[model samples]
Target: MTAAVLSSPGATPPSKCFTIDKEYPKPTLPSQTWVLVKVKAAGLNRAELRGRNGDEPAPPEFGMFVDEFHPDPPKILGEEFVGIVEEAGSETKFTKGDHCTGFIYGGGKAFDGAYAEYVICPSQRCFKLPQTTLSWETLGATTMSMWTAHGSLFQAAQLTKGSTALIHGATSSVGVWATLLAKAQGCTVIATTRQSSKVDKLKSLGADHVLLEENLGDHLKKLAPKGVDCILELVGPDTLQTLALPHLAKHGSVVVTGVLTKQWAMKDFTPALIPPTRKMTFYSLEPGQEEDEGVEKVIEQVIGKVEAGTFKPEQFLDRTFSLEDVGQAHEYMEDSKAVGKVVVTVP
Candidate 1:
C-alpha cells in the first residue's frame, strides 16, 4: 500500500512535512466490526497541517478532535475520504464493493487513515453513499463539509424552509454548502465574504444577496431589515457577537461552525444570552455524542439530496491532485486563497 506519512515537525517548506511510503504495510481489520476501505479520493484538511506544525506530541486524550490529534509522528494523515469497501468484518453491515465515505476515527491515529490506498475503519462510522452521478472527487471533498453544514443548519440552528439565513464567511467549504442547502430548502440566503471577487461566485450558487464583510450592519439593513432567522458564523473571531448578534431576529438561531481566527470561545459569551430561544448551548459533532444520535441520518439526508439533484455539489470542488502529488496539494492548500474544497485522487 502507498501512503503519505508525516515525516517530521514543521519545516521551512510546508510540503516537507510529508514523505511518501510506497511499501507501507496495508492495514487489516482489528475486529469483526471493522471494514477495510480502498480509498478512491480524499481531501487535504487544515487539521492535518496543524498536526504537522505542532511543537511536539499532544496528549493521548487529544485524539478525540479532528484538529488536535497529532502525537509526535502521526499515521497516514487524512480525516475524511470516500472509498469502496474491499473487505468487511463478519458482524458488519457493509459488504465487498460498497461505496462509502466518513470521518476517520482519531483523525488518522486510531487506524491507518484515508491518505493511503487502503484503510481499516469501524463499519458503523461509515456513511454509505448512494449510487449517483456525482464523481469521486466531488464526493470525497463534499462529505465532511456537507455533513457539518447539514448538522449545523438542521440540527443546531433548526433552520426552516422560509427562514432567512445569514452565512458569514460564505466562501468557506462549509459556508458554501450551507448556502446551497439553505437555498435549495427555499430559504433566503444572505452570504458574506471578505473578498469582493467571491461575491459573484456566491450569487451564482443561489445566495439571495451577497455582502462584503465590511459594514455588515449596513448590508443587513437593506437585505434583511427584520433580521435573519439563522446565522451561520464560519469566521468566528467573535463575529457571532460583534457582527451577527445585532442582526439576529428575535428568537433566532446562531451557530458558530468555524474558528478561522484561532479564537475558540467568545470574549463576551454572556451578552449573547437574551431571548429564551437564544439559550446558551454547546453542540457536539462527535459520533453518537448527542442524545438523538441522528448525526449519521443527517449525513445520509444531505448526500441523498445531492443524489437526487437538489443542489449540484460539484460547483464547490476547487481542484484535484494525484496521491503521489499530495505534497503539492498541501502546498496549494497553504497558498491558495480560495475556500473551495481541494481533493486528492488515489489512482
Candidate 2:
C-alpha cells in the first residue's frame, strides 16, 4: 500500500508519496467490534492541512483505547471515509458488503486514513447508506463537513423553526450545506462571502440575503434589526470579535469552527464590562471534545433527510483529483480559490 505523508510542519507540507512498504498490520477485532472497509474514496479537509503543518496537537485520550498510533507523518493523512465493508466482527448487525461511511476516530493523526486502499474502523462510527446515496466520492465528502454543519445548526445552536442564521463563507462545503439545511428547517438563512460575486449565487440556494464580509455589521443592523438567531462562524479569529458578545441576539449562539487566515495575526476588540443580554458560544469539531451524544443521533436524522430531497452533496464538490494529484488539491484548498469541497479518488 502507498499513502501521502506530511514530512514536516510548514505552509503546505508537500504531499510526499510513500509506500505502505509492508503488510498493513491486522486491526484487532474484539468481541462485538470492528469492520474491515475497503476504502473507495477519501475527502480532504483543512484538518489534514493543519496536521501536515503541525498546527494540530497530538492525539487525544481516546487514541489509546482505539489503537490510534502514529509515527512522524502518520501512516496516512485523512479522517472520515466511505467504503464497502469486506468483513465484520462478531455480534455486529452489519454484514459483508455493507456500503457505509463513518468517523475514523483519530484519522490523519494516530493511524492511516481512507487515502489508502483499505481501512479498519469501529462499527459504531459506521452507518448504512440509503439506496439514494451512491458514489464513494459523495460519501467521503459529507461525513465530516456536513455532519458538523448539521450538529452546529440544529444541536449546538438549538436552532428552531422561524429562526435566522448567518453562515459566514456560505459557498464553502460546510457553509453551503448549512445554508441548505437551515433553509430546510424553515429558518431564514443569511450567507456571507468576502467576494461580492458570490452573493447572487448564494441567494439562489435559498439564502434570503448574501452580504459582503466587510459589511456584516451594517447589513445585520439594517436587515436583522432584532439580530440574527444563530451564526455559524467558519472564518475563525478574523470574524470572532465583531461577531461575538453584544452583537448576538438575545440568547443567540455562535458556532466557532475554523480559522482560515494568516497565522500570528492579532485582532483588536474593546471588551464589554458586562455580559450582554445576548449569549455567545464557541465549538470545535475536534474528536473527543464535544459532549453531545445528540450529535450522533442528529447525524442519523440528517442522513434520513439526505435520503429525502433536502440535502444534496452535488452542490459542494468543486472538483475531483486522483491520489497522485493530492498535492495540487491541497494547493487549491490553501489558496482559497476553489469553492466548496475538493475530493480525492483513491483509485
Candidate 3:
C-alpha cells in the first residue's frame, strides 16, 4: 500500500512534508470493534492542513492522540473518507464489502488515516452508506464537513425556524452546509465571504443576504436591525471581535467553528465584549464525543435531506485529485482557490 506520511512537524510546506510510502504495510484489525476499509475517496480538511503545517494546535476530533510535534512513526493525515469494508470484527455490525462513509476520530495522528489504499478504523465510527445514486465523491465529502456544520448550527446554536443566523466563510464546505441547513429549518440566513464571486453561489443556497466586505457591522445592522439571532463564526477571532460580537441580538449566540485566519485565541478578550444577554461559544468535534452526544441522528437527518434532493452535495465539490497528487491538493487549499470541498480519489 502507498500512503502519504508526514514524519515531522513545524510550518513546513506540504510538498516537503508529505512523502509517498510505496511499501506501507496494511493495517490489521486491532480489536473486535475495528474494521479495515479499502479507500475509495477522501476529502482534504483545513484542520489536517494546519496539523501538517504545524501552525495551530490539532483539534481533539482528529484522533491525533500522540504528540503531533514528534511522532515516532510518520502520521497519516486525512479525516473523512468513503470506502468499502475489506474486513470486520465479529462484534461489529459492518461486514465485508459494506460501503461506508464517516469521520475517523484521531485517525491520522492517533492512528492511520485514509490517505492510503486501505485504512483501519473502529466499525462504530463509520456510517453504512444508503443505496443511493449519489457518487462516492459526494458521500465521502459529506461526513466531517457536513457533521461539523450540522453540529454547529442545529446542536450547538440551536437554530430554529424564523431565527436569523449569520455565517462567516460562507463559501467554505461547512459554511455552505450551515447556510443550507439553517435555511431548511426556516431561518433567515445571512452569509459572509471574502470573495465577491461566491455571493451568487451562496444566494442560490438560500442565504437572504451576503456580505463580501471585511467590516460587516454596518451591513448586519441594516439587514437585521436588532441583530442576528445566531452566528456561525468560521473566520476566527478577528471577525468574532470586530463583526460578530457587536451585532448579536439579545440572547443570541455565536458558535466559533473554524480559525481560518490562523488565530485561535482572541487577544485581550474580555467578558464585557459580549452584548448584554448574548452568549458566545466554541464548538469542536471531539473524539468519541459526537457518538456520546447522539450526533449520528443529525447526520442521518442531513443525509436523508441529501437523498431526497433537498440538499445537494455535488455543488460543494470544487475539484478532485488523484491520491498521489495530495501535495497539490493541500497547495490548492492553502491558496484558497477552491470555493468548495477538494477531494482525492484512490485508484
State the displacement of the C-alpha of residue 181, model 3, in Å, after optimal TM-score superposition: 1.0
Would you list the C-alpha lDDT of every candidate in the order shown?
0.75, 0.68, 0.79
lDDT of 3 by residue, 1-347 (tens): 88987766543466777778889888999988888999999998877787777654544334434344333323787877998999989988899999887587467656778888899887667777766677778777676788888888877888889999999888888888888878888999999988887788889888899997666777778888888899899888766778888888999999998888777778888898887899898776655575676765666676777888888765677788888888788889888877678999987
The prediction achieving the highest TM-score against the true structure is: 3
User: Who is ahead in TM-score, 1 or 3?
Assistant: 3
- Tens digit of per-residue lDDT, candidate 1, span 1-347: 88887776577475687788899998888899888889999976666655657544334323354465545546677878898999999998898999988676465654457788998777657777767667899888688788778778877888899999988877877888888889888899999888887888889899989988788788798787878888888876366656777778888888877765555666766753455555323333665553265655665676677777776655678779998887778777766466678888997
Error of 1 at 298 (Å): 5.5
Candidate 3, run of 10 with poorest lDDT: 64-73
| TM accuracy, model 2 | 0.81
RMSD of each: 3.3, 4.2, 2.8
For residues 1-347, write the lDDT of model 2, one tens digit per residue: 54554444454345543333334554445456778777777777776766666564433412433454443446567777777887888866689888777676466666556666677776666666655454667666666677778777876798999999989778777888888889988999989888877777688778998888796788778888877888887776456665644356888887765556533222553446214665455544544443344544565566666666466655666778877677778778877765677888876
TM-score of each: 0.86, 0.81, 0.89
